[model samples]
Target: MKSHYSDAPKAQPILRHTLSVLVDNEPGVLARVVGLFSGRGYNIESLTVSETEHEQHVSRITIVTAGTDQVIEQIRHQLERLVPVHRVTDLTVQGESIERELALVKVAGKGEARVEALRLASAFGARTLDATVTSFVFELTGSSEEIERFLRLMGEVGLVEVSRTGIAAMARGAETI
Candidate 1:
């Protein structure tokens, strides 16, 4: 049997990636963007969108997703083809970047459990947004992993509920995307 001259390397395991997209701040633009992800069956772990440049009528959308290398590339390419999209930057491939997520965690417990929850929140730099005799609401801002860890710990103590603001990511240096 003749050996095939395969130039392709082995497939890599799926990895998490952060993507930043600049698009026109027009009606239906956000929907189109979200549709692209949904239509492709890609799961968006975290998503955040905000107007960044008023003069240019441009908005920035930051999305965190997990997929293999091929999936990531496909996502970037599809986003670029959208009519309202102006630029797509894959922060995961762009080098050092900063990614942050904000979450509000509520805990309701009595006795030592309540005390332990407060102590743990303090250690994680989470601020007490609201507090009552039986419940405490904490506001935390950090990486996704950090929030996950905090939530897990809070569950062990007494987690009532949680709300998150998704992800906001940007490249670290002078280069702006």
Candidate 2:
């Protein structure tokens, strides 16, 4: 006998989404926004916030998270209900968008290892920000996946430390949010 629900489709797949939130650049606003995620047990993969309109005291926050469609919609609705929130846009689903992240990587090596590191960094278009006999600092900017690949390769050479500025995303066309 066929089960009644056997032909139903599988559960929705979880997907990574980038959200752009415009809000008032007032103290505690960021805290409140972050609190919502924490309170709900949602995970934030990357978060970047900066004041975009100094005169208007408006800020833009770019948040990257992963969840099912329903969960993402719930988060968006909740954010839209916030007092200071001016706009909330899901860049990932809204249309074409560009996302970039910057990372400062420090590698310590010598001899062949140092040479290989320099070569790999050059091939990856990473700039040599600082260099010493024992170590070097490289700066790289690209998509999250690109940065991850660069870091993984660097680890094989001599990655010592890294500092990443979370993703900054914007829509491609004239549509503003």
Candidate 3:
């Protein structure tokens, strides 16, 4: 029997990517950008945006998502067509970059649990921002995985709440994304 050329839809391997977008810092710009993803059924795992060039009135948005190569390309292309979008850079493919996330983790415990929480936080370099007799609010800044691990440990102790600022990413050197 001759082997047939496969015509089946091959499964696409999902890849995690980080994208940086530069856009005009104007009203409704963020909403429209987010709308594009929501309307298209694209999932954004993490999103963070801020005005990077104050004088130029331009904002930078960092988005972390997982998708197939085709989907990633489509998302980038669509983003470029947005009215206020000036640039779309996939930092994951552009070379070395630095990515970080900030999270405030609240742990509520007492006695041994509290002691363990402090011990774990110390090892992770988590700083206690606020503390009372029965609880502690910790500020942790690191890669997303690091934050996730810390939160998981916190849960074993007394993880109560978590507020994350998402990912803030940039090129390693003089390059801008």
Candidate 4:
């Protein structure tokens, strides 16, 4: 006989989600957080951590991942149970949150290519963080999509390398979590 669950339809495609977690900034906290992801076989696309309130000894951990609605909920629930995690906010469900990432892109080229890189960077409002005879490093901050677009354009010009500070998000209004 067929299994009872065999007729169930497959779940929907996984959508990108951003989660902000407040935790104690004590040592080994980040490792524990990261370990939870790895141990559970979850994939983290973007991760950033910073001390939010020094006086309160709280740090914010922002993580971006792709998962179905149910999976996202499960992740959030699990995070909430972590000892060091003070709070977990799924910005995707919380509504109207501001999300941004910072990237430093290095492009190495000469002559017209160099000029083109500069022009493109200017168009994207990227600041020149460093410049050398044949290379330039641009610092940019924007939404993930905007960063992807900038990287694509830079690839055409001569992208050498990139370092990114992953998504940091917060709710728009008076909501604090």
Against the true structure, whose TM-score is highest?
2
* Residue lDDT tens for model 1, 57-156: 9999999999999999999999999999999999999998999999999999999999999999999999999999999999999998999999999999
What candidate 1 gets wrong by more than 4 Å, as runs, is 1-9
Model 3 lDDT per residue over 1-177, tens place: 655657668899999999999999999999998899999999999999999999999999999988999999999999999999999999998998899999999999999999999999999999999999999999999999999999999999999999999999998987555
Give the backbone clash total of model 4: 0
What's the residue-level lDDT of 70 in candidate 4? Answer: 87
Error (Å) of candidate 1 at residue 54 is 2.2
lDDT of candidate 2 at residue 13, scale 0 to 100: 95
Minimal lDDT window, size 10, model 1: 1-10
- For all predictions, the C-alpha RMSD in Å is 2.1, 0.9, 1.3, 2.4
Which candidate, 1 or 3, has the higher TM-score? 3
Q: Give me the runs in candidate 4 sitting further than 4 Å from their true place.
A: 1-7
For each candidate, how many residue pairs have backbone atoms clashing (under 3 Å)?
Answer: 0, 0, 0, 0
TM-scores for all candidates? 0.92, 0.97, 0.95, 0.92
Whose lDDT is greatest here?
A: 2
Kindly provide the TM-score of model 3 when superposed on the true structure, using C-alpha atoms: 0.95
Which candidate, 1 or 2, has the higher lDDT? 2
| Shift of residue 72 alpha carbon in model 3, Å | 0.7
lDDT by residue (1-177, candidate 2, tens digit) is: 889898898899999999999999999999999999999999999999999999999999999999999999999999999999999999999988999999999999999999999999999999999999999999999999999999999999999999999999999988686
Give me the runs in candidate 3 sitting further than 4 Å from their true place: 5-9
lDDT of 3: 0.95
Local accuracy by lDDT, each model = 0.94, 0.97, 0.95, 0.93
